[model samples]
Target: MKAKILIVLGLLLLNFGLQAKEKECIKLHVGHNEVPENLIEKKKSITHTHHLSGHEPVHIENHFGDVKVRVWEKPEVKVNIEITANAPSEKKVQAFLEIVKIHSEKVNGEIHFKTDLQCLASAFENNINGGDDKEERNFLRVDYEVWMPEGHDLTVENSHGDVYIPRFLSVLNLHQNYGNLFADHLKNERSVIDLNFGKGFIKSMKGGQLNARQTALLIDKAENVVMTNTSGNVKVLMADHVDMKTSYGSGHIDKVSESCRFQVKYAKEFILGEIMADVDKLEIESSHTNLELPLCVKGRYDLSTNTRNTDLVLKDQPKVHYITTGNDAEKRMLIGTTTETNATKVRVTSSYGRVEVK
Candidate 1:
């Protein structure tokens, strides 16, 4: 009877040990792997590097600096950070560096890199963007250059700085304000890019789902894109399965391979190029703008406009029907569609503007 009780107690202890091992959080400090080295003397620049094991989600946060990421063929992750500042005095610069601390914690295969920036959040209040709200002055900036293995998820949040990633093949989530973003090539399955009052440019990206919101956006190629912008222009060279909304801006879409849905308000111009899908779906809404949608192939279309200067000029001249509603001055809504079975469904609406579809 005593042996049986001892066996049961041993099993219970083993179970608790396993649970504690699974939930262990390892906290690392700087200078463990390499010493903090100063790169530049006059500008007060310093660099640090940390090497990590295993693959997992990584999060990085910076208040004022650039962040660059790249993928390598190794199985480990390496982080390189550089901090630069231009202060009024050397003592102030040293004080700023002392206040900025790098904290890294790894738990359950996830790594988080953070810095203490609460000290400077109340110091630098300056009018930067010609707006009523005062922005924070960047007395010091910490730029990061990280290299990780492929297929690891990453999230970065940076403000008043730039973020650039080249050749990434993982899930990426980025948030940047008052800075620029440039992703050279992205092979991720999913990504979310959010920018406020900044410019964004992407090139040669392949993904199943992508969501981006920027003040100005430019993309070379994309698939399954959802984007929103305000007060800035957008341009895309080639895309598939896109849904976009814009306000007080213009859009120039070059080639669409599948489907597109666009909504614009107070736009200057909206141009849509060729549609090359077998069964495409195009939907557009415009107000106080001019739109041009030139169809390069034959498809079924449903178009409507409340302005008198709208025109539908089809070169092939398929079967069509039309209906007009309301008075000539206040409203002159025209709805038209082509009668065809197994055809692409296209719907468009415009108010106080001209839309030409061909």
Candidate 2:
């Protein structure tokens, strides 16, 4: 019996030891790999400063990295570029760094800065031809930080990265994809933005045009602007003389001071919060939509619906004249008018949806 007990204790100790050893092996396997000296990342920085004549347009193009632009009081354009290359060996990294470059020049009175990665294709082809499997871990990226004078026309194009501009007081032409744009204030004669698969946040815009696809845009205040979106959502807190078009999306306009027009199709919901008394014209056309609008007592509204429901809540305005024609089975027309002499003209048309006016 004593020999049997001793054998059992030995087996239990062995099992515990095996468990501890297995845990240690797993911990070591999950740990991060130590980087070798040859495999360390190589970095390079290039800076260029050009004294501008204050009338030249600055254009920048980048891919696979971020671009940040800020305004300065100096009459010069300064660009700082950071390049990073990583590969399996120091020699491979050096090869990649040799081909990746930034090309900057003055062409037709325009300052142009572009990322030159065309030679990388040849480098990759050479690696494939040589049957090198180490190219799989090779990567190169370039980022830009630019500072320029105010009132200069600036254009930037980027892909797979973010673009940030704090305050731009000039014409801006910004195009981006698979990224986001954050602008504090853009004030100028004209600004155009084209974005896809991204989000845009503009705190204030004086006059601009925005074209977006699969994006969400938020503007705190916009004046004399035109916006078009596809499969996106737009929200504007204060809009003046703005025209907006959205398809397969949604929109919300909190307040309108001058004039506004909205065109929405296949939208989830569209809401217009309020219209000031100074508004001259307000128009809305929608299909397959759910919309909500505020009824103004000093306005003349002409509403038409085709095969849909209309809910007009006029509990507070008893002095208003409201009329309805046609039955619920077909197209219907409703007109509401107040006794105000300089009443604003409001038109709303909808099909196969609901309209709620209060």
**What C-alpha RMSD separates each model from the true structure?**
15.3, 14.1
CA shift of 349, model 2, Å: 1.4
Candidate 2 C-alpha RMSD relative to the actual structure: 14.1
lDDT of 2 by residue, 1-358 (tens): 0000000111122232233333211000000123234455777899988879959999999876679997788999999988776656565456545655688999999999998764433333322222223323345567799999886899999876788988888899999987788888888758899989889999988888989999999999988888898999999999898888998999998888888888889999999888777887788888888888775545454444444454444443554554455465333323345343456666777776877767
TM-score of each: 0.70, 0.76
Question: How many clashing residue pairs, candidate 1?
Answer: 0
The TM-score that candidate 1 achieves is 0.70
Best by TM-score: 2
Q: Which clashing pairs does model 1 show?
A: none
Top lDDT hit: 2
- Can you give the lDDT of residue 179 in candidate 2? 78
